[model samples]
Target: MDQVEKTLNQNRLVLFPADQLQPGERKLVKVDQIEIAVMNVDENIYAIRNECPHQGISMIYGSISGTMVTSKPQEYQYGMENELIKCPLHGWEFDLKTGRSVFSPNQVSLHIYDVRKEDENIVLYLRRSPEKVIVQDFSCNHK
Candidate 1:
């Protein structure tokens, strides 16, 4: 009998198509060997690290809603929309524009990346080393 061989390669995951998401939806995207959360806030797109720094949870899987659309501000801004993502576990609110944690006043922000639409595809490039991996735990990658 011959032993079966198995190996895991990360290059097999498909993120999403450019048109799969609409304005106000968030999608988990992996590109350039990086995992991130892509969000379409009022037609403008944003890409940030999918893992929440607080507890290393996948922010993409969390409960996300447009803060501007759901909770309107007292004063209106020129380019402001409901684009805040609230963590379902701990209820940490983050502003999609700056990726800053609203729950923290001291500039706790997520790792942001440069995302653009190229022809018919949405592309995201790594801005820096991924601080946390949302798909796996800190000490384990077995999953």
Candidate 2:
């Protein structure tokens, strides 16, 4: 049986082709040994970790909407459309652009990653370099 494999260490990961995502759409991807969410908000690229800080649930799968803005008691306004994602179970709204709590803005936040559409691909920059692996079979050459 062939048990050898080749691996490339990388500092970046391409989630998918840029054209696959349209404005206001998002995709979940697992690459570079991590799960992340890539989103296209008005043609802008945004990426974040999929886990919710509060409950360890899939945060990217939550509903996308704008957070509520207010002026006074009983007087409220909805703004920043498509910039917030509400948790499916807890209803905790998080800012997609800033990865912070929409209202609290300090109590909690998500891990945001550096992402961009480059060379027709959506690339995520990893914080650490991945280890490269290659097997050197000396017996094959000597025997």
Candidate 3:
């Protein structure tokens, strides 16, 4: 077998059948000590942490929407259609592709996992670290 196949066979955790998941649907799964929310958007599969960072609420029941941008007053732009998942408690939105929070893109984010399809099964690979946290400099310049 190849390298990917070897890794899959070694650390792959099968969640469910690929055909059972439909577009715009999410499934909650527990592997080891982590809770993951597997989502299907327009036939693409994505997985993220099921707990919200703010209130520890379940993010599986969160709503999905497109990214909304407002340049100025009365001007609104909507892009990245069906790619954002909003927290159910405080309405915090996170990008499904990168797991970056819409409100605080540089700081807070979710633990996104890498998913793959293996012979009709949906598999989740084990990550070295459960979550990736990035810290940015917040200094200001005075002129």
Candidate 4:
């Protein structure tokens, strides 16, 4: 038997097995000295920074839930369930997909990385610069 070849990309990190983290589960991982919160929200995996913009607390420990929204002035509607991560200390909620603050989107935001399922491995791409987010997909570039 021969050894199976893995990914050649240096920026890609094999976080864990796909079966290890089920839907609605969260795992805290560190890559290049940065703490990241990898969550499986209804099987749509999302990765966000563990640091909160407010008090610099660990966001991974924050409660996962939705907030109330309203279109009319006097109406209140609950929306965006399980898509927001609250700051454990300050109760500030941030969207997992966009990594932006719910109340003040432009003012505060978390650094989010690209994540996907590569075969049986859950991979995350560590992005150092904003412009170099996706220069190319190595897996697609090759066979």
Candidate 5:
């Protein structure tokens, strides 16, 4: 487990495991004290930081639907669901793919990780400030 930086590098990280994350399932992974959300989008996998940049809320427990997360508080009275992770306090919508918030543009975007499949094993790569953090050795036999 190494430290992931802000720039993506191909050789820095290793493949953890190859497991298809089905829809509606949440995968919690840790990379150097950072909790990441490994979500399953269709047949592919995507990773992003679990914390929301708006107010530091865990995105793993936020509103998740398909590939979109709601950061803002849903207006149930106005009928707002399947929108985005609405922060539950302020109301924001972050696109799952780009980790961009619809509410705030200048705000920092969610840290996105690079993921790829290697012979049925899922490998993730993250860019750190200095170097790349590679997390191999994920126990796929546990569950």
Candidate 6:
């Protein structure tokens, strides 16, 4: 593995005190040269990349709301309440639970990290993919 990848895989960075962020609030953190947006939704912690895929804007300034859909005229369905984050610049909605864009769930997505409570601190796990390493090796050999 590359040195950076190895270091990331072995590290579990403590972001902040778990109680620092109140429910329905978000905070921005930097780790390994990447900006991460950490949120507390209904007491559950979620972390995602801070940049919006559309315009590279900071998603930490975005607004949070529920997922809304319409099945028919004048019939609107509301679900996944308080679990959606809308980009402040372009209004792109992302599901905090799955990190998928509401408009293009299949194609567009946000990079999400696993967050957990380690004692009184919030810990973030930087995940690395073995498949990515294998792909890099295959490309290097072909080149």
Top-scoring candidate (TM-score): 4
Model 6 scores what on Cα lDDT? Answer: 0.71
lDDT of 3 by residue, 24-133 (tens): 66676665467788777788888888888888788787877887776778899888777888888899999888999998989989878888777877777774422322
lDDT of 2 by residue, 30-101 (tens): 544566777777787887787888897876667777766767888888788877777777988888778998
What C-alpha lDDT values do all the predictions have? 0.57, 0.67, 0.71, 0.70, 0.56, 0.71
Candidate number with the higher lDDT (2 or 4): 4
- Considering lDDT, where higher is better, how would the candidates rank from best to worst? 3, 6, 4, 2, 1, 5
| Candidate 6 segments exceeding 4 Å error | 1-10, 70-74, 128-143
The clash count for each model shown is 7, 0, 0, 0, 26, 0
- Candidates in order: C-alpha RMSD to true structure: 10.6, 12.5, 11.6, 9.5, 7.3, 11.4
Worst 10 residues of 1 by lDDT: 134-143
Candidates in order, TM-scores: namely: 0.58, 0.74, 0.76, 0.77, 0.60, 0.76
Rank all candidate structures by their TM-score, best first, as comma-separated numbers. Answer: 4, 3, 6, 2, 5, 1
Quote the positional error of residue 93 for candidate 6 in Å.
Answer: 0.3
Error of 4 at 112 (Å): 1.2
Model 6 error, position 37 (Å): 0.8
Q: Write the per-residue lDDT of candidate 1 for residues 57-110, one digit (tens) a residue.
A: 777655545443333668643333356666656878777667788667366877
Report the lDDT tens digits of candidate 4 across residue range 20-125.
7677677777544567777777788888887998878987777778889866888888998888888879889898889999888999898787888778777777
